[model samples]
Target: MTEPTDKVDEQPLDEYLKGGSSVSRQYRQLPGADVPPSLDRLVLRQAEEAVKRPSRPAWMRWTAPLAVAASAVLVVSIVLETGLRDETTVSAMQEKREAAEAPIETRMIEEPASEPSANAPAADSAAAELVMPVPPPPKIEVPPPASASEMPMTAVQRRAPPPPVAAPAPAPLEEQVAKAEERDNAAFVADVARQKSALEAAARERELSASQRAMRGEQAGVAGPRDTVETPEPKAVLSYSRPISASAVVTSADSMAKLEKTYTDPEAWLKDIRQLRKDNKPEEADRQWKLFVAAFPNYEVAENDTAREANK
Candidate 1:
């Protein structure tokens, strides 16, 4: 019975070692178990929180050490500088103290030595030998004064005086206006003189024509029933005719005449011309235009039908 029981136990053990049990087969056939969704979410959330947890800044990692090192360096430097300052100060103070004590030590030694003694003569001779006589001051030679020819010229003497500044230039606008006014006055005087001469000439011509007419009439009376002679028309006289020069003779009468009112101002003259045109006196306007052009050659006329027609 014991042997059979042993055999039974060995058979079961062999089956278990061979993995041929029903339990093992059933375990292999079962579906694989998965982690719970809640557990998985909890783990993942924990991982994220770990990842997101704020850590010390990278700069902070080195800042403390760097600050420590810098502070150490500063301290070392300060210590070294302080030590050097102290050494220099101590050295200067020691030198000053030594200098201050030197005069007192010298006085002490001289005072003891200066006391009367049995070997006074010997001491006196020793002191006399030790003490040196003061040296005489060096002589300064007086040089003779140099002659003017021998003396070197200074910078001020060599430099020449600056030239005088030139007078300021005249203002262009004022000068132009003055010159234009002078020209206008000259032209006006000349025109007046010319007009006066022309009037005088016209009067003379008319008188001569009348005298000839009378003489012919007398002749006709003497020679009766001859063909009637036609009297020639007198030439048309121009107003404001003038030579352009200072030599023109302007009489006081001409200046005082109503003709001077025509061209006193260029604008006024233009207005008169415009007025003449408005009044249907084209011939008179045209003649005034010609005079205006001659007087003020550079003046710009206003664009109008009258000016255009006159220009044509």
Candidate 2:
């Protein structure tokens, strides 16, 4: 029984030494994992009867683990050395500061800001070294790390303002003056044209009056030569009227009372004058027109009609 158990244990080694039994078959069946070419060649050489190669040394089996441990030890040593160096530097600086301040107790300097006496002793000069207090460590207030929802928002994009527009320059002084003078000249010409039109209208009115008077058996000629001619008094005329939106025209009692000797309506008096003219009665038409003027002193027709009749 002992012999069989010994054989069972050694069987796997023997099988490996020989072609490596069932495990090799199962390894070959892994879907995409290919056996390395070098490993396959080594296995082929081992399987052949004539091929002879030295087995790997025992120490070679521990090579990978030893390399890994060496790397880990190196990294750990570097980290520890860095920490020790930092601590040593801080302690050295503290000791140096204490050594510098310890000498201040031996001296009796009252004013720290004032200069020392010019004849001070060498020992006092050496003892009166300037001492500055160590600055406090900066308070690095590290805020808690924000969660996904509390993260700061992106910077807002600002729109640039519109660019300033250039304004047009004003006209030159000389050009402005020329334009004003041209405008004045044009206005003067328009005034002259208006006066000429008024004179032509007056001439036409005089001709019509002469013809009408001639038909009514009245003389149609100028009164006398220029030196002896007397210009008649100018008749008054008014044309102001109420706007269309106003209520009916309202006459005062005094105005109605003043119109005693003439027809109430200027229209009726004008019609009566026209009828007398048709009957070839110039004197009667003239008389009625005079009464019409007295009745409605503000009639615009009074000036034109009176001018026509007076010239005739």
Candidate 3:
């Protein structure tokens, strides 16, 4: 029973190793961690020594140990036998001989030439330190000649490095939208202000042009008829259309009647005229102001008096 059990345990390991049926896998299932093949052979020798009997048959006593020793040699030779696979021709044999005798480190690094396999066995790490793979020669870039004529016909220039990727902004979508909207509103307000300024500028420019023309006319002994002269209409200032305040009353009545009601309150009348100016109805305000002056020439109101001159 013990013999059968021993055979069963050792059979697969020996078969895989000797038959070259994935020897690495067989080694992987060994009892110890990172147990080398040499160490394994030593351990097996010790195990055989322990299992031997002085009274056993001479044939069995020697044969078992001899078999175990043979297996160990076979394993060692198998790994070293890169030459045996190609024994067909003299050239192949010669190449194999050259490869077989080569240094272990050289054999490990370079491929056996005659074989089609470009694959080299992973060398033992202990032996790898002795002969490191030769470092690739340094690449020294020779600068172009100072004279343009001496420059190469086609020079290989390294491509520029790629631009760094920008990270996405941390702000939320709603915040971004709000910011964009705020910018748009600010731009709109600025444009409106510019347009208003342009209109006001155009009005001043027209006035200056008219004054220049009048000066020219006076120099030529010509007087423009005052009654026929139409005043330049004031341009409307751009502003938001505000909803009427609760306190602001909307009344539909004759301008004269409205003026008469506010006769006792000159400040109220002046405020109404200012409102008219703001509404771009300076001409109507001027007409009502004239009526007020006609109604009360002796009445002295500073605001009204200033407005009277401005209207004229």
Candidate 4:
């Protein structure tokens, strides 16, 4: 049995190597072993039909997704539009409500004013009385008075003369005149003193100017001209006073010039005003602020930059 099995396997291998065997030929020739002619024709026809048929457009692949996306976008837009419309409607309704309530509120406020109060009756009665016309006074007719000649004389004609009028008591004219004379004397004395002081100041100023001129001339190596006529020193009519120095006058003038400085640039002016405030010069700051307003009327200023005191 082992020998027969080996022989069978060897026989098939030998026939396969030899190209083919009768059984292989018989299998190949079987009714449905190879594809039928009709099946080949049908397959070829199907292949031809597939090739001839037009392919779907490339864009068709995205149609469903694009449609879905468009639907989603349209839905979102509609929702947003609806929301906006709702918001607008709500706002309009709110405005309408406010407008409708405004008149009611006004009426409520006006009703109290229109209605009569506790004192209305008394005020109305007083007004009515004032408005009413006044009645005319009754006329009284009397017979004409008898003439003076016909009138009876009760007493004799002798009447004592009226007492002589006394003159008004004299005012304290002498005392008043003396007081006025004293006041005038004092005023004259003060005036004289003031004039003396002024003259002294002028003399000092002239002396300073002369000295400055002399110094300048000396520096330049030239002789300064001297006045041929000398002004006499003014006599101290009332009292002598110390004269102001040239340096003091110069310093005061410098300060006055600084205070009177004008600012053309608004920013610089504002900066200086702030600096004044920082330096604790509120009065100067306020004054400068007023000047700034006058200089630039259209310039806007901050509230805190105004004067520290409300009254200012």
Candidate 5:
């Protein structure tokens, strides 16, 4: 059996070499001098056929895999680099945001007042750099914003004081009435005084005339002058007596008593004789003179004896 099996295998090999087998065992083997020309020719034909046909190039065979590997490495490197950069960026942004939200410290500044020069400019940048930092606009006490209802009303201020109010003028009619009243009062007082003086003068004139007429009549009876030849003396008229009513006159009790004591009717007649003599009216003064003659008869006797001698 072993010998038959070996012989069977050798038969297959022989058939493969003869190209008469249904199956063949193909393998690369070294070329030999004993190799058939037909087989060599077949092998050469196969090699020529393979050479004539197109093939995948060496660079093409691995290009897809190498491209995939390179893309993965780039993705991983970019992810790592992005992760590293994000930490610092996020930290810087956060610090900037905090700083922006922080409140600023308040400060106050006062600018000095100065006399402006005509030639100097109002503001200078060089001067501003040298100037102490203006801390801030004087931190105006910024009171919290007021509600609409609490807003203060603004009133316009007057540049000058309001004009003075004028006093009211007097009415024309009232002014005229005051002036007229002043004039009327003065005229009334003057008229009163003039009337008093005139009345006093008339009383004195009447008293003198009455004494002269009385003396003239007595002298005319003694001389027997013709009435037509001699001018007649004017008659006298006595004026007012003392007022009877107390209401009509102002008088003192002493003055009233003195008036009553001073003159009886006969004494008044003697006063008339002396008053007539003082008036230089001897002719019509006899009636007043007769009272003195009756009072002193011896003086009348001397007067009659002198008259008798004159008649003789």
Candidate 6:
């Protein structure tokens, strides 16, 4: 009831807005200018405009897209590389597995067993490339079948027959006897001939030496009687005991006749004389030729002086 008589009641905020307080009235009386509805909103809008200014950098906007693209490229590269490696590994593994499961066979090669030739090269490259060959078993030899007599001997063999002791062989009786006789006769004849020839040569040399001495004395005017001249003794001559008898018969009985007969053919004697000349036995050839001429004066071509000169 007291409030109704007073004329004014307690005011609410909306009523206070219609009638201003001291502070609000002062603000209202300042000027009739338009005020913003929200000061905070206006400040926010100014800050957004400052951020969009021309002088500000735009790098932040492009950074996110660049990073995303780089990440995507890196992921794609890693995936492709992984796929290739997996495919290669799978192919290699499959090939190895197939080879391991396959069957295997072994084969042998044969080669001749012989000594290498010395003329071949010291280092043979072909031999190095060759595979080693397996060695064959040793060969076994079978003995031949024994005869009936040899079978009994083989059964009776004790300690292998003492390895068959060999005996010295005897020389032939007839050949030995003939060789002994020939050697004895040859030695005897050679001794006799050598002695006779030595004696004859010594006598001839002495005689010639005495003659030369006498000639030297005579040249010096010293004279000597013929009976006082010194002479060498006559030498004994060697002759065969008996002539070899021939199957052909002749009328002449003396040794000279046999000599004439032997010299008549003249081929052997001529050949012997020629051989003596070839052997440089001129003294023996002279003696033999004189005898031949004396015995075979009627021989063919032997009587010719030209043939005799050629022989000399």
The model with the greatest lDDT is: 1
Candidate 1 wrong stretches, greater than 4 Å: 1-43, 53-58, 78-82, 98-312
Candidate 2 TM-score, true structure as reference: 0.22
What would the per-residue lDDT of candidate 3 be over residues 1-312, giving only the tens digit for each residue?
247775479878778768667667677677876678999999999889878845567688789899999999999776545343222233333322332222112322342211211111221221132123221111101222333233222211111121233125324433544553343233223322332334334445444544655555542112221211112111211121111100011121232243224332233344455556657787978976776666445434332233453744
Instruction: Estimate the lDDT of model 3.
Output: 0.37
Which consecutive 10 residues in model 2 have the weakest lDDT in total? 233-242
Q: What is the C-alpha lDDT of each candidate?
A: 0.42, 0.37, 0.37, 0.41, 0.34, 0.37
Clash totals, every prediction: 0, 0, 0, 0, 6, 0
Model 4 backbone overlap count:
0
Candidate 6 segments exceeding 4 Å error: 1-45, 48-58, 95-312
Q: Give lDDT tens digits, candidate 2, residues 95-183.
A: 33332222221111221201122222431322222111211111101112133232222111001111233123223433443553343
| Cα deviation of 178, candidate 6, in Å | 88
Question: Alpha carbon lDDT of residue 244, candidate 6?
Answer: 13
Q: Which candidate has the highest TM-score of all?
A: 4
Model 4 Cα shift for residue 312 (angstroms)? 40
Candidate 2: where are CA atoms >4 Å away? 1-51, 106-312
Q: Write the per-residue lDDT of candidate 6 for residues 195-285, one digit (tens) a residue.
A: 2334335534544544665555542112211211122111111222111111011112342233323332243355456557667888887
RMSD of each: 47.0, 43.7, 39.9, 42.3, 56.0, 46.8
Off by over 4 Å in 5: 1-49, 61-65, 98-312
